[model samples]
Target: MTEPILPRIRPAIAALAPYRQGKQAGPDAFKLSSNENPFDPLPSVAEALQHTTPINRYPDATAGRLRARLGERYGVDADQVHVAAGSVSILHQLILATASVGDEVIYAWRSFEAYPSLPLVAGATGVQVPLTAESRHDLEAMADAVTERTRAIILCTPNNPTGPIITSDEFATFVARVPGDVLIILDEAYAEFVTAPDAVNGLTGRLHEKHPNVVVLRTFSKAYGLAGLRVGYAIGNVAVLNAARATGIPLSVTSAAENAAIASLDAEPELLERVAVIVERRTRLVEGLRAQGWDVPDSQANFVWLPTAERTDEIAAAFGENDLVVRAFPGDGIRISVGEEGSIDRVLEVAAGVR
Candidate 1:
């Protein structure tokens, strides 16, 4: 058979791999790969999802109610809030709005998997600054790297996989060093789970007021247990958020997601109780892992990072064989989410052997 010629494809897009999710565990295995809420949905969330809104019609393109609620909570106008299917979607939208070919998007290395991926989608090159030995953002180096071509900068606090958060002081210093014209994205997807006293609080401090170019991205997926529903929001200057909206697919935020997000907000107290449980589990996991002679990073988020060095793949396979599936990054480390209380002991047991 003769080979057919393929249509022209962008060299960058052709070389890129699709976003890799955590491995799916078998039926009997406990999946600690994805950082997910272990508890069932709150009553309000379930009730909201049962809404009789006819799905035949398109949803409110702007997600008005949710935006209004978020605005009220954050002390911002509704116009200052932007809602999307997920925080990750908002990221791509913002990057598309701010960057283009020859521009650069800067972020910490081995941070959120999406950070390295988003810029390319916008036809912008990604500038990944290496994380410090403690697995934290080297904000000083990042600030020093800023140039005229730097269009967007993403700072993942309570950074995914590695587990350390950017502190308030660090954020202040970094922001001051960077040019005001460049867009700064604070990806706080796991913000709700953070317990450190001095960690940067985004919307609560009215960040956009202090820094117009800065935007904070948060999601209903983590603490609210609305992962599958895909609702996320960004708080920033109305004009900046409007730019992001211009680049986004309209009506992508469904009615179900909006309703569920609102319900999650209404049941915030109850939802936070579940978060508290996860935080306790994180404390146990960190302390337990260190006791086992494993040098685990202190995680404010619900997941813990286990640095297995050259043994990363082998240790991950060992975990899989024991029916405890985790996320492994080749030679780097493994990220184990705080799962059921029973799984805690199981994870520690597995780490004991692997260590």
Candidate 2:
């Protein structure tokens, strides 16, 4: 049979590479590539997924109950909360809603991998300002780069992969500089994992009141151990969130995810204890790497960064050989998630050898 000819496709999308998740591991290995919660789902969360979801029927298309629940948690009106499959989904929806061909979306470089591609998918241009020497966002540089064509800006606090967070003061100053018309997405995906005293916690600070243009994104995928379930939300002003909701695919969030997330919230006290454990582990991992003469950043998230520079690929392969699965960014560095307790000793041992 002859190969069928393809129909017309957008030049930008056709050339775009798909999002790549972290590397998986074999049974004998622990997958430390994805910055996932090391703990299993709590009893309540599992029970909700098993019993609360009725698979034979479609879920609530609007997820009204979940929206109200999250709104209460963040002290916002129901219309101000937008629930989607994940925070990343809301990101795509917002980019599509606000930016389009000939416009620009700005974010920090060496940030969440999704930042670069999400803009292209929306047919918008991306402007990436490099991080500071200490591996934190150069917010001033990002603000300076914005133009009249800029429609959206995404800020990942406890910035993924590298792991430093944007402090509350830094955030306030940055917001003041940005144009009111530009949509600012403050991705707090790793907020629960942060242990820093001054780091930005959007919900606690009531960001919505002061910055109507900014939206805070949170996910049940990280600290809640709901990664496989796929549930997340955005809290922002009514008009901005409504615009994002309009662009989203209907009912992409299943009843299973919504119920599980609600259950997770019900079990917040227990879940936060587990987060404390991960934070402690992260502290140990950072100290261990730094002690081994490696240039590791102070991470407020569940992962530690190894700024391997030219040896990124080589070092990543070495870890793989030892059954320690980690994420590598070619020439940049490696991001090793703080995983099983048993994995810690091995990680330190591997680092000692590399040093």
Best by TM-score: 1
> For residues 31-119, could you state the per-residue lDDT of candidate 1 as single tens digits?
89999888999777899999936988888988999999999998889999999999999999999999999999999988999888789
lDDT of each: 0.92, 0.91
Model 1: which ten-residue window has the lowest total lDDT?
A: 52-61
Candidate 2 lDDT over 158-215, as tens digits, reads 9888999999999989999999999999999999998889998888888877889989
Best by lDDT: 1
Q: RMSD in angstroms, all models?
A: 0.8, 1.1
Clashing pairs in 2: none
Error of 2 at 108 (Å): 0.6
Model 2 ranges off by over 4 Å: 1-3
